[model samples]
Target chain A: MRYKVRELTDMQNSALKEIINIGVGNAATSLSKMIKHQISIDIPELRVEIIEKVPEAAGGADKVVSGVIMHVDGDINGYIMMLLSEDSAATICKAINEEEDTDIHTPMNQSMLEEIGHILAGSYISSLAEFLTLDVKISPPMQTFDMLGAIMDQILIEMSQNVECTLFFDTVFVLEGKQMEGILLTLFDPMGMDKLLGRIDEMT
Target chain B: MIIVGMADSAVAKKPEKLTTLGLGSCIGISLYDNRNCIGGMVHIMLPSVENARAKDNRAKFADTGIPDLVDSMVKQGAAKHHLTAKIAGGARMFSFSSNSNLNIGERNLAATKEVLDKLRIKTIADDTGDTYGRTIILDTETGQLTVKSAQKGEKRY
Candidate 1:
């Protein structure tokens, strides 16, 4: 029988959160090193929720932001995403380029954001793989600036087709002293989630 | 303003506006009847629900959602013949070399128009297909739709 996301036990739930925290923490480390700014991450949240509620749950659907998305392949299948507020995107851009301007729309700046996202995602997914002992690889990142819902609605649509519930794992992080924040989000399909839970079971 | 959410639909009459936010690849179809000043909006994720496992959510697909919205508008006193449609938000937000999921937006946009055509609803305005996101609001009184984006500014049609 397929294990539903909501069927996760309390122990499983906390374990899931811990796994996500490790992934986000790894990303935070990579980001802090690249930007040379202190990164502070909040406790990661892992929830199994209906697809329609995801946009509202993450943030308002219309909130404008910068987004970086990548598809995960190999042993696990899912999408890894980053959503940055305008302030966070600009602040990160400014730090990386050592420029006074804080714009992320410039071609060079956009690419920088993509690379940063790639590095962060690489670090994040590897930790997940290592902990679960699963082989995984990620596609090149696609970066865009748009409304939060617009940036991720397609992924939700694709996920919604197969299952009524989705795993929404997110962590909010800030660039210290700048007070600029961003969100790291990962969506694993139900089958992939089942595999993760199976691995977690083996460890226990 | 009433906000229609993904796989959700809403209907209203004069003085009440209908809006849908954060349309990346999903299509937002707005229907209006100027005679009665009735407006409706549906945020559809897929072109059809025929293949879906869950058939209960009619508002989640273009084939079922648009007709359902129209029927509800008629039930709310909007004349069917006078109904005109305005649509926005079918953006290819991200692209990958081999990923078909990213192309859902284009497919959604096409299916929406096809449904409207079959229903004989005149499509008065269309703002779709790009690499950005859009938020749209439909004014029931004027049947005007305002499309807003992060960097694209705003436009009404």
Candidate 2:
């Protein structure tokens, strides 16, 4: 049965939020370890919105962001995006590549960002998998620097074919001393909502 | 100037531009009439609207959006015979998906081209089917379409 995103009950919303909160915590911990600094993440926000409103979650439709895109499959399939402002990306890259490693060049910045993205995503998805008892596999990260709306258009086009609305888990993170902020977004497959809800119920 | 959102379409006249941002796998189809200096752009999400559980959004699918865009341009003083088209976007962002159903970028572009042909709109230029995303702007004044991307910089057609 097809489920309307807007119809999610308060209890369902709370459950999903809690689940995502755990995932975000794990991601933050992994990031902190990699950067060798304290990282703090804001309370994750969960919402069900039309595709157009998604860009607003990251800032605006025209907001330029450094994005790392990946697809999650196996039990519950969907798209996961790690979006960072150009400044935040630069900050993270600088922190990670602090040593005067001559090997790191201009184009290597992108590779460094992708590596960080992969580490964070791996932690987040693995947390979700362990918590939900679902085996989820993630595709390799594809990096892009562009307007958030355009990056989203890639995933939302395929989604719009089946579901009119999408569910997103949005989290903001700040590197404690640096105060650099980034947003991590998870656009859950609308078709997988039923399966996800069922799994949630099983947990409770 | 008019800004088309996801699954939306807009029309404009001379000196006005139509813009849409972040066109990953979605197709941004623009129809311009040089004679009248009128233009219309549609951000179509799906290949076809037929069998869609939700038929209310005509601009959300190629089959319906292309015809509707043509009709709107004709109504707004654009000469049907003078209309030409340019399109951009339709990128396959995820490379690891083995599922053919995930090849929506190629499907969307093919379906858009087919619909444009059926409507007799001559496709003048297009930048589609790549791993990168694009933001497109259509100039009604000159019928010049600008495609901007972070990886490839910008191009005008």
Q: Which candidate achieves the best TM-score against the true structure?
A: 1
DockQ value for model 1: 0.85
Give candidate 1 misplaced runs (Cα > 4 Å).
Answer: none
| Model 1 lDDT at residue B101 | 74
Backbone Cα, N, C clashes tallied per candidate: 1, 3
lDDT of candidate 1 at residue A46, scale 0 to 100: 78
Tens digits of lDDT, candidate 1, B7-87? 999999999999999998999999999999999999999999988877789999999999999999999999999999999
- Model 2 clash pairs are A149-B22, A150-B22, A154-B25
DockQ for each numbered candidate: 0.85, 0.55
- Model 2 has an lDDT value of 0.81
RMSD of 1: 1.5
Tell me which residue pairs clash in candidate 1: A150-B24
